[model samples]
Target chain A: MKKSIILFIALLGLASVAYANESQIWGEMRIQNILGYGQEESLKLGVLFTMLQSKYFAWVFLGVLLGVPLVFFLHYKIVGPKVFPHSHKKHYAFNLFHRTVHQIAAVSFLVLLPTGFIIVFGDFFGGGTLVRMAKNLHGLFTIPFAIVVIPMALMWLKEALFNLEDVKWFMILGGYLSKEKQIINATQFNAGQKMWYWVAILGGITMILSGAFMFFLDFKMEMLHNITGLSQIDLLRVAAILHNVMGFAVVALFITHVYMSMFAIKGAVYSIITGYVEEEEVKILHNAWYKKLKEKGKF
Target chain B: MSNEMSRMKFFCDDHRCIECFACSVACAEAHELPTGISRRKVITLFDGIEGKEVSTSIACMHCTDAPCEQVCPVDCFYIREDGIVLHDKEKCIGCGYCLYACPFGAPQFPRDGAFGAKGAMDKCTMCAGGPLETNSEKERHLYGQNRIAEGKVPMCAAVCSTNALLVGDAESVSTIYRKRVAGRGKGA
Candidate 1:
């Protein structure tokens, strides 16, 4: 009888323990190990994010900030502005459709760059309501900025393609630094402009891909990473680096492009604004394009 | 002075944990933490599988190389001489970058405001509060009890009935854990 009682108690204890474990599991269903997120991904994200918070990024930001004006100053001091001889004859430099697209692209870029910079350097300004506003605006502008770049790239595709003449133009530094009017044979867009177009197109695509992933983080990208033989963390690190590096490089190129169009070349800004350039200006600057226009009797 | 230089650590022996969740409750009650935030949580993996059920209580590991400190955008986190990682609440912008950076998901943000507004981060301080006057009411209110300042164990560690959670200098904690595992006929 004593042996039987001991056995019954042991069986009862085991049953109660199992039942308690089941209840415990049901109670803590929401709690998870590492909260169901990959620890390595967080570590990599932390490391990169810390890097952005460091003084290195600040110094690089300062360099890019000050470098643009210095380049412009040197150009102004050494080369002086390009002042074409006056001509009353007007030529259709840009059509209404192209000019409209250019204006929209310029406006969107103008909004995106400042807001983007504010978010990037939020610590210096002491992040608060303004930084939050900048972040939202940056996200909002990305849509229009991304949408406009694709159509604009397609529209200017033919003229933006590089040819043998572009090599000559690049060798002479696009004739901007020359004392005399050294004409390098070029079409509607110069070699420098062609390079800028390509950078903008490629960089825009990169930004969109990375930004979309960051925005919609719920995507099952880990499965894709598994198939590709890369850990999720590795993929995230690569994406983050590409997005940031490409974004900064394209921003630098943009500043130079703006300075060239607005300050260095006198008629360039007016041409974009009014959709017209002087006939003599085109003949002197874009000789190849002018000859082609004449041959077609479109001038 | 040597104790100050000593690296502090926390260890949870799964063999001893009963999954009672008293550690989590004790921590919350001791800290007076808001309802939505939990400083410690007990997670049971593969429960009700006869021999496979494993329970462990987790909080901030106070990592030797902490990811939270690395990822804070405002440079809010600071590590003490004893390796206790803490952060300044005033500087924290509630951007949730630290949440992404932490491997243990130790960082907690209170969703008190509308549209799911995230309040500043709150985490396990190892019973050490923020950069405030130690044991003051302000410190207690913002960061919870500073048991470490009083030369006492953390409340969660203190109230653990099973003694699963152990906290101390690295050498001592490891020694205790090593002996316990040995008693159970397991490799340390």
Candidate 2:
């Protein structure tokens, strides 16, 4: 009875949180007027209605706030060192590509995250000396950040493709959450990790595209004019929403990925940082690849 | 007050508009609007429709109840006592809600700011002063054609060669319209 009551209370709390982030009343009225009525009415109802639909940033924030601690607790308590102990075998060859990609991703994401946040919250927190400084920094760093993100996306392109093994790995929860060690013969990156990689790349591309369009509104791009069929003002409004959504999505993914790597899987952090792992841990986690590398005398 | 309201409205005669874009160019020139930003445009609907193609000069309606004023996040838009809806360029963040809400595609933005930054919105303000102090140079440069204060009609209405465009109070303008419709009756 107590457990059921606790669950009920938790559900209610979640329901309230969901309701709190609802779009405004006027936005609802506008949507109804648009979908049910004619274009004339919809145009009269105006762009404010569309702005309400672009509040994905709120969801991204909630996902991170809840997902981070939950992942950490699950990793430490439920699936700690008992499942996967620290490895010391130093399998450097297998991790070389992974390590390089991880570093680039980390750096690019670090820059993107803060710049994104500043852009969103600039209205409230703007005009301060510190915020002005941060804005300058954000503008400066975004150039290199954009440069690295493109290559990072291309590097992970092959692994993100959907394959039969990826499907099976997904069906079995990537054999990470489930205690079935036999199902662990998955591909280079597990299904869950691959999903994260794909989202990062796709979401990153959206941010870059929208951000670029917004930054160059002054240029006479006849193509853009024809495509949106909107005045320059409308284009900027659309860009703002896209940039905000992608920014939040990237932040949420980063938090979850970090928690899983650093605290969830024992010794997962060490491999990336040191480029080495114990022989026993490798044999347990990645036996097939480990044995092949060893036979080739590449490790 | 009726005379004041007369300066806030615009009308185009469908019969006289030749779809030549002369009025559109005149509006832009009157405002000194920057390149690629047009406060007024000619929308030619139904091209080659066997005498049914309609060309209308579109700009701000200066609506009795403007939606742009209601939806602006910064409260940048204001309706003058004469009912002309004008916005403060300095306060505008280039969000474009006004462009979306406007029924006539009156609001325009410069496309040359850093990062495609939307410059402040420019639109037909019924030839009235914006939120700036009355008759200020800043107001003249940003809004353009402040004919309301000069006791004259708007440039678009004045420059209309065929006298197709009219600007005045709702009742008087509608009366003129009814007279025109009545004059064309009985196939005479």
Residue-wise lDDT of candidate 2 within A1-299, one digit each (tens)? 34543654464355335433421111222223224322543332245433442334444555665777677677567755324545334656335665675676677677666655554443444323443345345545555545455566666677566677666766766556644455355434566777788777788767765665544433334466598665344454566567666666677777778766776565577767777765555565545555676787854
Q: Residue by residue across A41-154, what tens digits does model 1's lDDT show? A: 343444555466443554565678688779889988898887775466677868887888788878878987887677667666676566656655666677666656666887
DockQ of each: 0.30, 0.08
lDDT tens per residue, model 1, B1-188? 37643788989999889999999999999999997578888888888998888899888889887877875556678999888999877666565566555656577766542233455678999998989999888899989999999999998889999899999888889889988988889835
Which pairs clash inside model 1? none
**Which segments of candidate 1 are over 4 A away from where they belong?**
A1-55, A85-87, A216-219, A222-235, A278-281, B1-4, B18-57, B94-123, B127-161, B185-187
Each model's lDDT comes to: 0.72, 0.60
Which stretches of model 2 miss by more than 4 angstroms? Answer: A1-87, A93-108, A111-150, A163-186, A210-251, A262-299, B1-9, B18-26, B43-54, B62-84, B95-105, B115-117, B145-152, B168-175, B186-188
Accuracy of chain B in candidate 1 (TM-score)? 0.94
The interface root-mean-square deviation of each model, in the order shown, is 5.5, 8.7
| lDDT (Cα, 0-100) at B44 in candidate 1 | 88
